[model samples]
Target: MSSQPVPCKNLHEWLSFLEGLHTSEIDLGLDRVLTVFRDMNIGKIAGCVILVAGTNGKGTTIAAMEALLQSAGKSTGCYLSPHIHFFNERVRIDGRNMSDETWVEAFERVESHRGQVSLTYFEFTTLAALFIIARQMPDFALLEVGLGGRLDAVNIVEPDVSVITSVGLDHQDWLGEDRESIGFEKAGIMRPGGVCVYGEVNPTKSILQQASAQNVDLRVFGRDFGVLDADSEPATETMTDSPVFLAQNSAQQPIPDAPVPVSYQMADGDFVRTVLSEQSIPVSNRLCAIQALALTGVRLDKIDIDHCLSLISVPGRFEVDKNNPKYIYDVAHNVHAAEYLSRLLQATRQRRRGKIVCLFSALKDKDSKGIVSLLDKTVDSWAGWPMQVDRALSLAQLTAVLGDNATNAECLPTLGEAVVRAENIACDRNDTIMVLGSFYAVAEVQSFLTNRANRSRGVDEKGIEV
Candidate 1:
């Protein structure tokens, strides 16, 4: 692939052409992707691949790993799904998005390589991501599973370390309804003798059985490692006003162990030490994600961890826009993620004085009712909109699931209108507005916010009114 950019007459035309490939939105099978991969010779790429699969926390885990590796000064490539703002956000190198010219070249390569086999939208994009990553030849690559790991397109590449962040009731239509069924599908990413890490609070026995059967070197959080708040210490004599904390590892130490006091300046020392000492590879960003990566055997120094954590930024995940009435935008589309949002709202409301106004939209296949039921009581008002996508649930369909309990419910056809209405209803003093449900919703609102910010010129860099 040459650096000379591939000239496209129109970007929309290219996008439309790509979108016209498959009839079904999601067709889970390995045959089509495998054929394309074989033709393109994806297996020849020389680097360690980390395949991350879970109902939720997949993006967070991948982001953490990418940050850690980059901080270690290693060239890293990452491919995540359902881009929040831009299509390029799905693929990144050393934490920066791939150039449009690079994407165009990749698309062209995929088109040529896909001789007789027809690829789905995801399959096409997955190939494009791999093409880009292969060109870079980074030391490490992190691939986030777009769906269940069993037959997802990204699973075409065998990973050295397979990480299942957490499994819950999600993608039930395709995977299964119960935890065991879901766990089995996610466990598909594991290879013989590969390091498998589970971040779930309570992992099912089926997952363990599959790991054992596959002969995977498995590590589970809580059972193998855990994190807790360090005990408070008195003000230091030298610092005059400083609090200290410590991090300990049970595997490295025995019982009746005493916690060490970490300097206030080095608050994340314990996490950094744990990550560096545990992982085989030297990870860079120790502070932001080292704690999470520590469970998988990646380590970093205190300074490196701090730098990585400081540089990390994940859009639409607890992203706050503080205008006169604050707006909290989050991409919590699943039931488990929704529950977490509900807990956040409950906790925030306890300490702050505000009325929570929820603006939600979701795909037809998702557990819309379950998600809404989780936040119904916590929110002061509810507004629903159907996303501008093929699988989006109509407002009427959503209302049916909401039932009689959604007395304050109102329908808005477009996401723009829903956001405006939510903002209008919120008072300047203490009211808060939140946009959740689907990535589509957040993407649309983010575009609106960007445009609004550009036109006003009064908005801050964070896209908030001054």
Candidate 2:
């Protein structure tokens, strides 16, 4: 790094330089990152730290938790990964993305002491976010792991409360080939005597085993806690008008909404009469969020769940671009995420008359077949292009994974080109275009949609999502 580049002066320069620090994009291990943290003298953050890890629902859970905490008057610093639009999206202080100046300063801090330590792109950037958050001194620090928990750089922080959204096969190459193995790695974030919440519909043996081994106070969904799904009217055909997690089952019921007064029931015969404005999120997500908040000693009554949920909308995660010929956006790269996407697609527009076309693409390392098959039953057609990035799967590779379904997939030159084709098809068939697959796919599609919409008005695509 010293031989190749001069000092980085701006956010882009810092990011570019950091990307080249390591030979690989993802090098799993905390020794190098921890060493750098110590060198910078970054002790534990002033606020409470909550570590979130899992295959799916990490973002939603984090958003819910952050909102609940903030609504209860806690200033929060949140760090997430794989930003859809801007790098600043990764780190948020008090529900706002930190400015470019803050990032540049943090990057410099990390760079100064990382002397001989080679950190991966995620590692360096994660450290930078932590530095900024610690300096800002928020009341709460929510860290989302970039990869598996045991080795991810974020795991360096021993969270006071740990949340596992769900265990599934996604990063099979690094995490594991099955749910059991993956659960073990994710369970690494929990410490003895800490309050750990798992949102899995069916808790895996490995997760239970690990929690037991460490003597962590583990709460499992459906066992120790449960979400009393809000009994609300069916979501309108126009998804933009409603906030619903859309049922994942084939029946597409509206999660069998709870009574007029939605309440979350704890295992000990206690219940909190709750209000959630964002009723569209998964019940499991909300349940886990409340449990986490309670575990962290935040008063449930102080949280304006509805107001908080309304304020937090994650982009590239079922992001709605248009209404009529609906354009749904989600970054469902792996099988676990794909399952959630498939259910979301079915549950939302189940009664709508429009056809459903899922626009997709993925990197070479993902489980292309598993991801594709999960939504095949609901998607009317598929359209995508090999990503422009180096790790993108080739058209041939994608076709091979898609198999007989490949006949229905349209291979285009670029995602923007695919966007145009999808719009044309939607116009002809009255279809809803779902932009999904990798984060790159969602970002490109989001960019295309924002650009198209702004052509007449000429404005930068600035989205306020935490």
For residues 1-466, what per-residue lDDT tens digits would candidate 1 score against the true structure?
A: 2123335555445567767778777899999888877887766443778888988777777777787777666788899998887688889898899877788778887777777677788899899899899888888888999998988999989887788877778889999999899999999998887767776447778889988887887766544333323554422222333232223322222222242222222222232222122221112112223433443345444334544544555677666764433877888888777766776676557646788888888888888888887788888887777778878888788767656545477778777788778877776557778888888878877777777776689876576767
TM accuracy, model 2: 0.87
Off by over 4 Å in 2: 1-6, 228-254, 257-269, 273-278, 322-325, 428-430, 455-466
For all candidates, the clash counts are 10, 7
Compared with the true structure, all predictions reach lDDT values of: 0.69, 0.75
Compute the lDDT of residue 198 as modeled in candidate 1. Answer: 72
Score residue 275 of candidate 2 by CA lDDT: 45
For each candidate, give its TM-score against the true structure. 0.81, 0.87
lDDT of 1: 0.69
Number of the top TM-score candidate: 2
Pick the lDDT winner: 2
Q: After aligning candidate 2 to the native by TM-score, how far in Å is the CA of 138 from where it should be?
A: 1.2
